[model samples]
Target: MAGSVRLIPSGFEFVDDVWGGIYRGGSYMLIGARKSGRTLMGLQFALEAAKQKEVCLYFTNMRPKDLMIQAASLNFDIQSYMNHNLIIVVRVAPPNDAYAVPNPDNYLIDYLRDIITVVEQYNPSRIIFDELTPYIGFRNIELLKDTFLNTLETIEERDVTSFFVVGEPATEKAQQIINAISQYVTGVFQLRKSQSKINNRFHGGNIIITPNVGHTEGQFNFKYRIEPFKGVTTAPDVDDVPSKYADIKNSLAAQQKTAPHYVYTQSKQDKNEREVFNNVYNYNDFLLILNNQIALYKSTGQTFNLVSVKLNAMAQTQGLISLNQLQNSVQLSTERKDKICIKDNVLMLLIVRSNPNSVVHFLSRLKSNLPSDDIDYVETVWENISILNIEVNQDIENAEELTEESLNKAHQDPGSYLPVNKFI
Candidate 1:
């Protein structure tokens, strides 16, 4: 077992309420359907754990290592630590490659040995198995079960706090896996794909905690949304960690400001006479508009890109330099019929008939036109600029697919922009 260590706060209200803080050697399960924010939540836990100066080992078969690092930068600057080797990411093959393809006969034992070897090598204080489903195959069920159970035993022996992610929460396989390993784990948190009765178009879900060893048992309904630069935020008003602005300015940088004064609507003749500007819509209206636009894309097959621009300087400086940059960006984009709106300090641009490539091009070009990227201004005001293609669909879980390609690009990398504190 690893040596005893000081306890650390998770920085999440729900987590703090549930367990106070993570147990030094506890094991947890995060079960959710695909795209249910499982990875997001797991990353949040891992990032907090790493920030405590504890060695953290993340085991994942889903997202690549680069993507995970890029996601972490949203909450706080972690590149220095990653460079120093405090956080370690372990990438392993999925079940098909690990079992069926490579070692036909010794699948379970081989993979089991590999996982055990990883833990033994790193001996990290925290271990996260992101989406364990890929490792637990249906073939040779009994042996695979034994392999998994043995791995759990090894984790317990190591006295390492662990997190396991399971996709397809509603499936019998998830249930079977849970029943088999639930006793060994300290707790289970499930994220589901559920719609709210209050708003039909908005996609969010409930998180249920089934008690086991170290945490209280309870359920909480939470909303989930992704910010272009911020990754996944459980709340609409705030993110899991501080926004980029917080890195340079005081805490006030994250406080919500008075809504910008703008006209609601106007007639065609009035629009021609006056400044024709679309009203900055609220989150609900943004969803409604996005839903309608998605439907339009389905019918027309026209490309539509959603670009979220955060005025990181909005709260820090009254000079409105960042706001002007946003306006100029919007003005340049509107030439192509791209409509813009503000929601939660982010200027959301609905680029009609433009592909992801063009959106990226425009934003990058517009960035050059902004005030010289001063180190202080860049840190406090100019944060990451990312554009994700919108695949207007009812399935929220699959929404990430829209940004899959962009996530791999060099410009989308976090190192290209300023890092910020976690928006707790």
Candidate 2:
């Protein structure tokens, strides 16, 4: 007899002492309040999978373009992935009665079928629904529950990992949706703010991961920061930082400077030195905060000239021209006169196009300054230029080899259509 097939664990896997672990294959849900990093966390998970060479599908019901820009701003390498067809992003408008009604039975079924079609086509290892709360708002609770269960069942059948982000409940109706989904989820990761017992001081939010039914629960505290790269850093160990830093009570007293009379009588010079030390301490703290924010932005996988170049390239690809085109466009005489330089980790193009109105005339000349690896980047810059405006006779067409329906059909019968190994 064949051995019984075993399902793999799909919970958090800690990478470092302070850095938070990752969620592997399984159906998981993230429940949190507004502005609580729900969408950001989903994006982080998708990015992590991408880094691991697993295809990711992101489905959004809100602010899809804004999310794309946010991802770009964080330096997520989205363009490179898009160019390679490694990631697929789709957006759907929220159902009209989804939030107002108790259940949207057929409507949700249709939506799920569409999603399933996409999944069958892409065969992504990871799928993320940015927020499911809006969908549950106006729909029937029972139907919503059944729909979620069906979705999970479909995912399990396909051996795909999934994540759903749900907002905090504003009413009993909302809570019901959360309760229903939580029952079927393979793991639940809850995010909530809490106060520290040791110092009686408020700390950051806590992340608690509860495995489904019989699995062990994992919990951790994480603080978001931006720096050399966008990623999570573990909270500093209590034993690592000086005890004085952790002692809020003593630290508050120190700020008040209400020590004994002997301390006050020490000297004016001593008091000045103490003031200097305090200033240094405050500055260091501020730097740490700024660094974290910067790191968070970096984690989005975008670069300084990312949006500008993409917009420009998209415009040119679409046959549009603007004032910005003159600067980025290369000209024959200018190419011979100016030099290309790589400074501060950025490629700079110096062009001396004399004719301001004829940016397209210099396209060939500018092409020389761009490296083969960066040609796509330059093309994207022109595409964005065309996207902005300025009509031209050039016929640019984008031919996609696959569609949602076809992709789904391929997945349903992989051996007959898709590559044999793709099913495995």
Root-mean-square deviation (CA) per prediction: 18.5, 20.6
User: What is candidate 2's CA lDDT for residue 272?
Assistant: 25
- The digit string of per-residue lDDT tens for model 2 on 165-265 reads 88877788778778877988777777664443224432336565566743332344444322223432235445433333234334333433542222223
Question: TM per model?
Answer: 0.49, 0.49
lDDT of 1 by residue, 54-136 (tens): 66787777555454455655655444444334567666666565543655436646766687788887677787877677656
Candidate models: Cα lDDT each: 0.56, 0.48
Off by over 4 Å in 2: 1-24, 97-103, 193-204, 213-233, 236-424
Model 1, runs deviating above 4 Å: 1-7, 62-73, 76-78, 97-105, 138-142, 169-171, 195-203, 216-424
Predicted structure with the largest lDDT when compared to the true one: 1
